[model samples]
Target: MPNAIEFLFDVGSPTAYLAWHRLQGIVARTGAALIPVPILLGGVFKATGGSPPGTVAAKGRWMNEDMQRWAARDGVVLAMNPYFPINTLTMMRVLAGLEGDSRFGGVVNTLFAGMWQQGLNMADTQVLTGVLTAGGHDAHGLLALAQSPDVKARLIANTEAAVALGVFGAPTCFVAGQMHFGQDRLDWVEAAAAG
Candidate 1:
């Protein structure tokens, strides 16, 4: 049986989006199941004392350049979100609520592209609503579901589980029980999944 690759992700991370974009091809070639685990990056940061690259001016500049290089190398469209460090709590909650639904993949793609490619400021509820609605999702329903206690709890649980698994950053992947951090580590992830 092929291995199941667990992708622990937060949409706020551009590197996570890059990893996610490449993971589809890896999964297809390796015949591995891609399991998406939605976690709050902020929660993980707080739990693990992890800080965003933007916290340091030089690191943030370097990271942006690196992301641009990766995007060009991958031939993927990635624009730096003008509203950097947008709060994604509600969006993550909505993703948690949509888990297992057939529309989950579409929702993920829509949100990722909206934030990373289209420069949508998803941190604003009104902006998110418009973007999601335009993407064919029932924005009102998703927003309502996101506010539900169950969905909120699930997101919290996911974040806690990620921390327990030693995930200090976004775009962490698990292949055959081995943890791989960052989009740059995806080659190892593909090799592990192929085994």
Candidate 2:
């Protein structure tokens, strides 16, 4: 097996949501392992001097349109959440907690779907716990683990690592040590994987 593709993402980013939806096909076709690294987007922004797309009104508007089209084409739901800038720390830590659990992958997939497709606010404790429980995890246990100091530190460390790696955006794919930002660059990611 080849080295896994390191997928750095934050749940609050629509771009990351789009990439998450598209990644399943890429992993299947390329036979590449997917290493999901959930980070705080704000931390990444601070560390990398990157600005969120929403800062640019014109660009952000067009991006939302493009994203809607793409999501529809891919058969993924794209309901815009009212919480444009939701705090993702809670959700990220929960994801980190699922790291070694047998339910890790399932929880990740379902939670992403819950946010991007179902418009669920993952930051809310009730919503998070419900999603985890529905996905067959011990919600209370997972939440307790997620809230631990270790998980919080690791999430921060992950954000710092992404910045150190020169990643300035969400949905960045690190394949063969080269960073490919955005779903539009999946072709390049595929080429890199092919070799």
Model 2 lDDT per residue over 53-143, tens place = 8779998889889999888888878888766677778888877766666776787777777777778877888988888788777889978
Name the weakest run of 10 consecutive residues (lDDT summed) in model 2. 96-105
RMSD of each: 0.8, 1.7
List TM-score per model, in order.
Answer: 0.98, 0.91
Model 1 lDDT, residue 112, Cα: 96
After the best TM-score superposition of candidate 1, give how far the Cα of residue 178 lies from its true spot, in angstroms: 0.3
Write the residue-wise lDDT of candidate 1 on 128-173 in tens digits: 9998999999999999999999999999999999999899998999
Shift of residue 43 alpha carbon in model 1, Å? 0.3
Clashing residue pairs, candidate 2? none
